[model samples]
Target: MLKEETVRALEQTARQLRVEILKMLNTAKSGHTGGSLSAIDALTALYFHQMRHDPSNPKWEDRDRFVLSKGHAAPALYACLAEAGYFSRDDLKTLRRFGSHLQGHPDMNKTPGVEVCTGSLGQGLSQAVGLAIASKLAGRSARIYSLLGDGEVQEGQIWEATMAAAHFKLDNLCVILDHNGLQIDGEVEKVMNVGPLGPKFLSFNWHVLEVDGHDIQAICQALENADETEGRPTMIIARTVKGKGVPFFEHKASYHGVPPSDDELTRALEHLGHS
Candidate 1:
């Protein structure tokens, strides 16, 4: 069982990451806000508590890999990387600016901790599949994790990669769905029904786990289970609210790519317990 103190710390860290993501988007005045907010909790649990990585040695041979399959949520990944000490937190404000490493998507060559350039809807999972295959072939214990948006799964490539991972029995691979329901256009169901997600993955021969994405403890437990299980990959469906911590943005697809204005940022900061 996860300790209470540890759960509290993870929860606190997640909230902090959310605030930083909002700040980065607000500073850039252009970025994916809803998806970023939705993903920070899972990203936080990965960087802060789960993945084995050296911020100083990003290319460490044994380090676990992380891929943001839903590349639009780059702000969340960037914020988590900064908080994990990959780079200065100050760099977050440079997001989307010309000459900045923090581009609109996760660019591998540009970002120290980003493993691949991912923004195209369905390509990230394929990249993760390749990483997992490489790790297994090299007899490396390093695990590869990919976080995908529910909406992004509408892409055919996601299913192709899913089949490949299971076929290879890439037990070291784990994929997480930030199932926040809403996408840029509207709710995921109305846009593209990806429902019965758990059964779908199960049928594909994966170990499936579902958790409330906002619940840090549940997320940690699900990830721990994934690490212990062998023979095939695991897929965690993390149910989340698109604009998670901030009341004004919660459940609203309108905020999908809109950064918080000054007034909105103030309210969001307060809600996240920022002083």
Candidate 2:
């Protein structure tokens, strides 16, 4: 249940995420813009409104954990973590630079709030399952959440982890698929065709929900519902645009891994109400 004011705050936070993402990529001159921007709303809602995390004590034993399976979206995660007070926002400019804590991919040892080093894709869910299983064995109630790219789900390992999580009745684990439809090669349908995704998760013995990935309230509700569900892992198949919010980038596959140019970044910030 999200209060109206909290909803407003989340909207503001989403805008801030977009601004930071543009600024970070603009500074780094490399990284995935489409996927990161598309996942911003979901990431913002989790870090600001839902997850049980401590900025000061990132490794707190009882805190909820998040694994960004689609680790190429590290820009969005870094922005969310910084806004949540995990680290100073100024570090954003150092992304992908040598000796910077903010690397191209998240490295848990180097970055303060990153829970896992996940850039290879299709592996975070398995790691998340292990974490959830450990929590159950330790009698801790912490939940583990993983965000996967829809394209990454094409890998065989994803379904293996999916089966493992359900077989073990890891109800404390929730996975969100960032269904932005486009991947680096092309549209997911053309790349590998992992459609019927909602039913696919249901058939795998997991509870399934679908939501607009850009809507913070809907994202929160899906997460809340996942928490209440019992006896199985939950998956939220979030439908999103490849590049969201920016006029030129939205639904465009070319921007999948391309940073916006200086002119493009300026226009994007203006579109996001930052200019």
Candidate 3:
């Protein structure tokens, strides 16, 4: 259990990550907005409080791995990486620029902290599973984590990887589903529903836990439960608001692939208590 002070600090970090997510997207003028904001709290809990990593030595062999399988949400990962000291906070301003390392999608070859190139969708879990397999083979205790969008689970590869994880009993692996319910087209259910998500995973043989994604304390507890489970991987179904924090953006599908305009950015900042 987290102390009250620790929970408050994590909440503040999540808010700051949201602020940076907006700042980067607004500056780039192109990037996913809704998904990034929706996933920042989990990303925050991972980088700041959960994952074992060294920003100064990103390639350190002992570091635990994180794969943002929903690679469109790279802005959130980039923001957390910057906060984790993987790079200068100033570098965030150059996101999506012609020569920037912080590209629209996560590029492992280009970005210092990214575990793999993603954004093609549905491939990130495969990559994470492979990493977990390698960790087990090497007799390393490093755990692997993947964050998937609810819509992204529509991909066949995600299920394939899920089966592999359970078959291999990758207890060192944990998957998070950002169930914000909105995708580029609008509601995920309208596009192609993947509801009854928990039951599906349970049938696939994964240890499943559902929680309000924005609740930092509950998120922390879920991570703890994942750690305690043995001989099986864990899946945390995070029920989240598509565009969290900013009122106008919340649950709006239009913001999925859109960047906040200068005017919208000002309003967003005000809503986030920055103005």
Q: Give lDDT: candidate 3, residue 170.
A: 93
lDDT computed for candidate 1 = 0.93
Task: Sort by lDDT, best first.
Answer: 3, 2, 1
Provide the overall lDDT of each model, using Cα atoms, as 2-decimal numbers.
0.93, 0.93, 0.94
Q: Show the lowest summed lDDT stretch of 10 residues, model 1.
A: 36-45
Q: How does model 2 score by TM-score?
A: 0.99
Give candidate 1 misplaced runs (Cα > 4 Å): none
Candidate 1 vs 2: which has more lDDT: 2
How does candidate 2 score on lDDT?
0.93
Q: Which regions of candidate 2 are displaced past 4 Å?
A: none
User: Alpha carbon lDDT of residue 132, candidate 1?
Assistant: 97
Models 1 onward score TM values of 0.98, 0.99, 0.99
> What digit string (tens of lDDT, one per residue) describes model 3 on residues 84-173?
999999999999999999988999999999999999989999999999999999998898999999999999999999999999999999
Q: Candidate 3: which stretches are off by over 4 Å?
A: none
Model 3 RMSD in angstroms = 0.7
